[model samples]
Target: MIWNTLQLALREIRRNLLRSFLTILGIVIGVAAVITMVTLGNGATKSISDQVSSLGSNLLMVRPGQRMGPGGSAGAPMFKIADVQAIAAQVSGVKAVAPETRKSASVVVGSRNWSTVATGGTRDYFTAAGWTLSSGRIFTEAEERGGKAVCVIGSTIQRELFGGGDPLGEMMRVADFSCQVIGVLASKGQSAFGSDQDDVVIMPIRTVQRRLTGNQDVRTILVSADDGVSTDTVKARVEKLLRERRKIGENEDDNFNVLDTKQIAQALSSTTRVMTTLLGAVAAVSLLVGGIGIMNIMLVSVTERTREIGIRLAIGALEHEVLLQFLIEAVVLSSLGGLVGVALATGASLGLSSLMNIPYLFNPGINVMSFGISALIGVVFGFFPARRAARLDPIDALRHE
Candidate 1:
């Protein structure tokens, strides 16, 4: 009896192929939109986390001010080079410390001039930031002590300034001072926030203090913890030490901020997950609309097949069999639409993820869940029309046709 009912349902659907396709169109679009939005949003969140992790495995950032962001501290005292030395000497579990200061400068090698940020830090800055030298060597200790006019170039600057030629041992003008390029850094494409991490010139801290900015104030400090040390533990230690060094009373708030890359990644990932949920919810509204479309079409199908239904009843077919047939048809239609939509979404996700410069992650759980929900929608909505067809009196249904 079940096989017979399924055969009848398939026959009815096959007889009106064009109409069937049109009815299921809503399901296709709805499923595709939901899957595409979720897949892309997840990829974006993963990309953010990956980039943040690439900054360093165990890293802590210390800066003046009670908060972090673009806004500078108005009354907060900037950190001095002595602070970097103190942190290095006093802090336990610390692998390295890099005190940094930066300013915007125009770089020139003869007529090929380009504008970029000029940064000054000790060699530990590279180690703390997980930077590698592509070629040449880091600034010598003697050069660092003497405040020598030497610098390293990032990948972007190397490309923009040197083209195909080697930049090693070349003299480039940074602001008013001429500096020799001693090394080139390996590529670190971009930050999670979309800033070009490689668009900079790096020199020793003293060089920038004397030549460019003419100040001993440090803007940021990068700290790398020793192996197996917890970043949170390092952050806590740094905070406690700074609070004591700054002479803040127990009740008074410390004037500096200690942040780790893991904390930043988690915060950003949480925010992104919330946004993804909202987008997915918005996309799900269409599935409800699609369910209504399936219901409406099923109602029309029952009306047109009223005569056939009467004949089936006259031939000793049970009313429940007829009900099951219609319900099955609805489920088949919705499930088929879901499968096609998943295929479409997979293609779209691959293309869009590449265009957006992120990874394409396949989520089998979402695919199965979406397909199951679509079938469930069909059952819930198809019940009304199926029941209406089943409850029709044979005489009345025959008379109407």
Candidate 2:
């Protein structure tokens, strides 16, 4: 009996194919928009996490400032190499501690020159910052100790300066001094903030301080805690030691700030998720609109089929059977819309993710849930129209025009 009713519902839908398509258009658009927004949001969150992780595992950045951002550390004292050494020696669960300073300069090789940031630090800076070489070797122990005029170039610098030629054993003039290229760093693409991570040149800290900046001050300290160690614990210990070393009074706020990369990743991810939810909610408003559309069309359908309904009643067809047939028709229309919407969402997500340079994360659960909601919408909105058709008087309906 249910199968027969469903067949009748399908026949009626097929008879008005154009109207049925138009009726479910709203559902299709709503489902597509909601799924696409959510999928892209998840991709963005994943991209943020990956970029932050590229910085280092269990990483903490210590800067001599009460806060972060431009000029936030102004008037604060700069750290010395001794501070980096102290952290390495005194702090437990530490994998490596690197003292670093940076300067922007034009690096000239022969007649070709490119502007890039020059970072100065010991070999441990590579370990602490998760930098690895694509070719050549890191600074030799003697080169580091003597502050030799040697440099390691990032992939961007290598491409710009050498133009696919081997940069190792070549002399590159950095600012006023010439340094021999000893290594090329593997590409790290871009940072989370959209800065090119590969656009850099690294040298011994002493070299940068003596030649470029003309100072012995370290601008930042990067600490990499050992695996299985809590970064928060390490951060606390490092903070306590720095407070003692910098001679901060118990009542006075410390002049330095420690930033955990893990915490940064988590905060950024959480914010993205909140935005995703908000966008999904806004998109979901269309579903209600679609449901209303279904209801309006179903009511119109009942009015048009009044005479046919009366004939069914005269032929001894049950009232519930009439209701069931109309209800099934509504459900089938909405369900078809849901299926088409899912397909459209998947294609849009892939294209958008590629254009935005983020990952495509297909969530089956969301697709399934969206389809279920669309079907449920059909049941709720179709009921009123179906009930109206079932309650009509056969004699009066047959007598009407």
lDDT of 1 by residue, 164-283 (tens): 479999999999989999999998888988999889898999999898888889999999999999988888888888888888899998788888889999999998899888988887
**Highest lDDT against the true fold, candidate:** 2
Candidate 2 residue 51 C-alpha distance from true site, Å: 0.9
lDDT of 2: 0.93
For model 2, residues 278-387, the per-residue Cα lDDT tens digits are 99998799987988999999999889889999999999989999999889989998888888889989999999999999999999888998889889989999899999
The CA lDDT of each predicted structure is: 0.89, 0.93
lDDT over C-alpha atoms for residue 216 of model 2: 92
